[model samples]
Structure formats: structure tokens, C-alpha cells
Target: MRERVNQDVILGALALLFGCFIALYWAPIDSDTGIAEKVRSRWSIGDALAPTVAGVVIATSGFFIALGGILRGTKSTLSAKNLTYLIFFLVIVFSGFLTMRYAGPIIAGALGEEYRVLRDERPWKYIGFILGGGGMIFGLMSLAEGRISLRRLILALLIAAALALIYDLPFEDLLLPPNGDV
Candidate 1:
């Protein structure tokens, strides 16, 4: 029964990854802003695809690590709870990344260019942390059976904190004028 559930989790994660990739790559680039309207552009395909690639890689790695844990012993594997947490973390992480990418210019207009740049730089790091810490949590939960060490927990906490702090930093005001400017 648990094995079946684990299989489902793995399959679901894979499906989500594929969907995101399709949306990002194959989807039509907007006429005006280009894919820049979709997400932060690094002015190159590689940069644009980096986070998606990283997500797929980490999620794939977690799948293997989880399999290894189960094979070792069901006693040493991740529970449904752990998988839930992993999915939840990933959803928020990617959503935050997307929010910053598309909304950044408008936000920058209100805050300032510096804030925009800072905001632009954020999604990647958050993605990295989610992939890194989330992977570690899933792996350790699988191998240790809810026996994660304090240090591992702290690391994840730190990554979360870093992301939050970066997200909240205030930008200098640059509100748009009501009247059309020449």
C-alpha cells in the first residue's frame, strides 16, 4: 500500500516537472515583452532554463534517493507526510519565483531599479534553496525515517530565512506619475 503511494508521489512530481517545462519552453513567447513577460530573462536560453533544469534534476534525484530508502527497508523510507511537505515546499518556491519574474518590473517602478534587480536575483536562490533543502529533507526522511538531525533542520531553516529576508527588503520609492510623461 505504501509502495503504491510512493510510486504515485514520484509519478506526480514527474508530471508536474514536465508540465512546467512545457509551459516555459514550448509555450509561445509574448509579442511585446517576449518570454520576459513569463519569467526573468537572462538574455539567453541557458539562463532562463537554469531553474527549471535544476528543479527537474533535484526532483529526479529525490525520486532515486527515495527509492533507495524504500529498497533498504520501508522502515527507512519517507512517509506520506514527508512527501506532502516536499510538494508543499516546491509549490511555494516555484510560485514565488514566478511572481518575482513577471511582477518585478512593475514592482521596480514603485520601489526603484535597485529593488527590481534585487528582486530579479531572488527567484534563483529561492529555487536553489527549495531544491537543496527540500531534497535533503526528502532524502534524510527516507533514509532515517523521520530521524533528521538538528543540523539538517537548521540548514533548511536558514535557507528559508534567507529567502524570506530577501523577499521582504524594501526598495526606494519610484511611483509612476498620474499624468502621461513626455
Candidate 2:
């Protein structure tokens, strides 16, 4: 009997190596600023912060995935079903993003207001983020559970609201997606 390489192990190893390379070398060399810095007595994120955090997260996820594969002792292969799920997931995510980007502008336009001008204001700013983000949560949950429920919709909206608050309240300078673009 021949031993087959576990897909998780191979994928995880590649991710781990890629993440390490990014975090250790690419970010430091490419970025002009450090991950964080104090500017005029205010702490702020620098150019490298996003890439560094992403790398760390990828490495951590890879470590756990590899460990799980090792412990499970099962060979898993990517199949057509997995590809179908991936496509579905991508579609859902892109749809959600499109909603997030356009919902505010469309609603504002319908209400005879300009999104770019009113983006910083209350209600307007939260509209797209909450609706689109909630929709995303609802979609993903429905996809996973193979059913859509009112309860899930409510929960997803609440979670999205909380996330909007979390992002909005802390960073005064930060602009939500599409807001920056608009």
C-alpha cells in the first residue's frame, strides 16, 4: 500500500512558508514605515500593518490546519463538490461586496441625497455596511446549513450592526468601504 500525502498538510505547509516569507521579509523590505508608529502622540497603523497581520493570521491558520490533518490521519482530496462550494462561496462574497459598494449610493440617490457628500453622516454611513454585511452573514450561514431562516437573518443583521459599530466607533479617521471610493 502506498501512502498518500494529505491535502491539508501540503496546503498548510505552503501557506505557512508563504506567510513566513511575507511577514519576515517582504513586508519589512517593501514597506517604508513599520507596522505601527506614534505620529504626533497618536498611535497609527503603517503600510506594513495589513500585510504583517495577514501573514501572521495565515501562518496561524496553516499551523492549525496541518496539525489537524496530522491528528486526523486521513487523506483528503479536493473534489468537484469542493470546487462547487468554492464557486458558490466566491459568488456570495462578490455579490455581498457589490451590495456593500452600491447599496448606499443607490438608496441615497433614491432619497435625493448624494452618497459621497453624506457618507460621513449618520444613518447613511451605516446603511450599506449593515445591509450588505448582514446579507453576507445570512448567505454564508444559509449555505452552510442548507436553509434560510428569519432567525438567522435577524442574528446576521445584529452581528453586522455590532461590527459596524466596532469599526466606526474606534477609528475616527477610518472610512468604511465604498465610502472611501465614493
lDDT of 2: 0.88
Q: 1-182, model 1: which lDDT tens digit per residue?
A: 33445554555456656655544654333222333333454353433354555556655665665565456523326576898887866665565444434444445466655443453355422433344444445445444554657667666557655554554455323221111121
Error of 2 at 27 (Å): 22
| Top candidate when judged by TM-score against the true structure | 2
User: Which pairs of residues clash in candidate 2, taking residues 3 or more apart in a chain or in different chains?
Assistant: none
lDDT of 2 by residue, 1-182 (tens): 21386778877888898899899999988999989989999999999989998999998888888787777754556866999999999998988899999999999999998898999998899888888888999999999999999999999999999988899999999887768888
What RMSD does each model have against the real structure? 15.7, 9.2
Off by over 4 Å in 2: 1-76
Q: What's the lDDT for all of these models?
A: 0.48, 0.88
Pairs with backbone N, CA or C atoms under 3 Å apart (clashes), candidate 1: none
In candidate 2 the C-alpha lDDT for residue 10 amounts to 78
Q: Name the TM-score of candidate 1.
A: 0.24
